[model samples]
Target: MVREILRVTNISCGCNKVMVTVEDGSNFIADAVIITMPLGILKANFIEFEPKLLDRKVTAISDLGVGNENKIALRFNNVSYPCLYGSRAFVYDLEKLSDEFAANFVML
Candidate 1:
């Protein structure tokens, strides 16, 4: 059996209702809806809703930081450093590396 799927886009909200624009430029209305967009997009103020969110909720949202960091893997066919010196090595002030490199290395 085949199922029908509806794609709603361009959502706007007011105090008590939400308006959505569909692919065909048709409009839809709803009483309440849950938006599960990325926190980053929410933080960027890409969408707006009326009857503004509660003060505490707004504060929480503002305080939340989106992890914009990235990771890159540099795989090697063979180990460049000898293992005979022990398993651990020391590096000072590692934060000097680029943000992406620092985030990736911290995971190791």
Candidate 2:
């Protein structure tokens, strides 16, 4: 059961169980755990992991560059496609259409 939203300070993936510690000195243990924290938090080392992430995983996370992204949810009362708002980016490219577009766009 999820309690209040508290600041997570540590995560330990042990052989028996996974432990998640919050700033309020509370620990949550479970048989399995899934963390969905942002890349910034992982890159900043905000929360300490007990054993440590693998070297390749650490390198991959460190290599990931974080950029500014703005998200806005719009509500259109009269629109037929209620949630079909187009998300656009002002990308300047020499080619009209290029495979580079695929590389730049990521769902998450």
Candidate 3:
């Protein structure tokens, strides 16, 4: 049976069984486990494993750089534009801005 896991901080697996430790220091066992987290979080090494990730995987994780992009959409009730059907949207490349401008801008 699969139990609802919450805030798992560590995972240990053997040939047949999987073990997980929650934030409250509670341990549980399972047949299989799936971890869902961002690449940055996985690279942070906050979660401990019985045996660490493979060396190539660790290197690949470390080699990745973080990047962010914004997407915008516009809607109209009755108005129609010239390129509405063909080219409906335009992508504003924020990467074109200076590093200083990007650093100062806030998403929210």
Candidate 4:
């Protein structure tokens, strides 16, 4: 299998042209471009374009919220708890009950 890779840097936007500096320090231009990057990076102002983007697009981008989630995996050395049939043990807090809870052990 063959893999093709392109590395672009020093991106700049003009009235009708998109300029970029390649790995070899050569300049390249394009007419129209579509950028598909993480919303967080765009919000951080890491990449700058010559001409600002559309107001709607900017608003849409700013309105977006990105979050970080973590998944944990646990392995018990021994099964100390007893299980009967299909019964399961879960922890809950009555004072902090949330509407997002659809099931006993499920959280949204």
- Using Cα atoms with residue i matched to residue i, what is each candidate's TM-score against the true structure? 0.41, 0.59, 0.56, 0.41
Q: What does candidate 3's lDDT look like per residue over 15-60, in tens digits?
A: 7998999889988888888778777777898788887778998899
Stretches of candidate 1 off by over 4 Å are 1-16, 21-26, 68-108
**Local distance difference test, each candidate:** 0.63, 0.75, 0.72, 0.60
lDDT by residue for model 1 over 1-108, one digit each (tens)? 211344444677776887766557777678866557778767776655454667898889989987767898899897643233333432444545677766776675
Q: Top lDDT: which candidate number? A: 2
TM-score pick, better of 2 and 4: 2
Off by over 4 Å in 4: 1-10, 21-26, 68-108
Candidate 3 CA-lDDT value:
0.72
Task: Sort all candidates by TM-score, best to worst.
Answer: 2, 3, 4, 1
Model 1 residue 16 CA deviation in Å: 5.6
| Pick by lDDT: 1 or 2, better one | 2
Q: Tell me how many clashing residue pairs each candidate has.
A: 0, 0, 0, 0
How far is each candidate from the true structure, as Cα RMSD in Å? 11.3, 9.3, 10.6, 10.2
Q: For residues 1-108, could you state the per-residue lDDT of candidate 2 as single tens digits? A: 665567789999878999999998889999887767789989999998889889998999999999999999878667432132235323333234355643544221
Q: In model 2, what are the clashing residue pairs, if there are any?
A: none
Error of 4 at 12 (Å): 3.5
